[model samples]
Target: NNKKGSNLYDYWGTDISDVLNQDESDLIVNLASNEYFKAIDKKTLKANVLNIVFKEKKGETYEVIGIYAKRARGLMVNYIIRNRLTSKELLKDFSDEGYRFNQKLSTGSSWVYLRG
Candidate 1:
């Protein structure tokens, strides 16, 4: 957790905003954990940030197991680096470590992946 009364936006909001506003697709695929990425002030960013959630299906429910979820996030980063994937569509091709994209459970900005 962040130190008491410490806020990310107060430290690096402008830098993050500038990066997002640069001449790239106005999309930010936020893979950072909730605590760390909060350093960026969303209002200042011109990019549309896409957040992905990973889950495991348990009987009648879906849940994120912390350790496995961390592994899954790393695997996804590995896949991106290895494949040089730029298009969001390529994200659907991710199957490393047994996770699969779940289209039926995804929304416009948030994508979900599941493994069971």
Candidate 2:
């Protein structure tokens, strides 16, 4: 994930703190403080996350929703929804650059099938 920058690092730290201990009063008083409450295009968000997953593993599209980044190698991420095809289609395909339109067009398919 290209989420490796100073701004992202700082922003995530702040975001987590705000979410972890938020109360009803905080929610009502500091609506703007809830970064997660900020409007975001769900379609674009899903697409971007899927694109990142596809890059790491070709033909493997993951639907990610919320993500929590801690000061560790592992990140706590959530998926928007679970797709049955992910594991089956991802085992053989490896897209180091993630999923791209060109690749889909060249392959003449949107999602691919593969053997486990």
Q: Over the stretch 1-116, how does candidate 1's per-residue lDDT look in tens digits?
A: 55533565665747867776885786787777767777777877777888877898889888987778788888888888899988888998888877888999988888889988
Expressed as tens digits, the lDDT of each residue in 1-116 for candidate 2 is 34543555444544444443443321121112124424322322212112121212225642322231111002101121222223323323332223222334224122332211
Range of the 10 consecutive residues with the lowest summed lDDT in candidate 1: 1-10
User: Candidate 1's C-alpha lDDT?
Assistant: 0.81
Number of colliding residue pairs in model 2: 7
CA lDDT of each prediction against the hidden true structure: 0.81, 0.27
Q: Give TM-scores for every candidate, taking all chains together and pairing residue i with residue i.
A: 0.84, 0.15
lDDT of 2: 0.27
Top candidate when judged by TM-score against the true structure? 1
Error of 2 at 47 (Å): 33
TM-score of candidate 1 on Cα atoms, chains taken together: 0.84
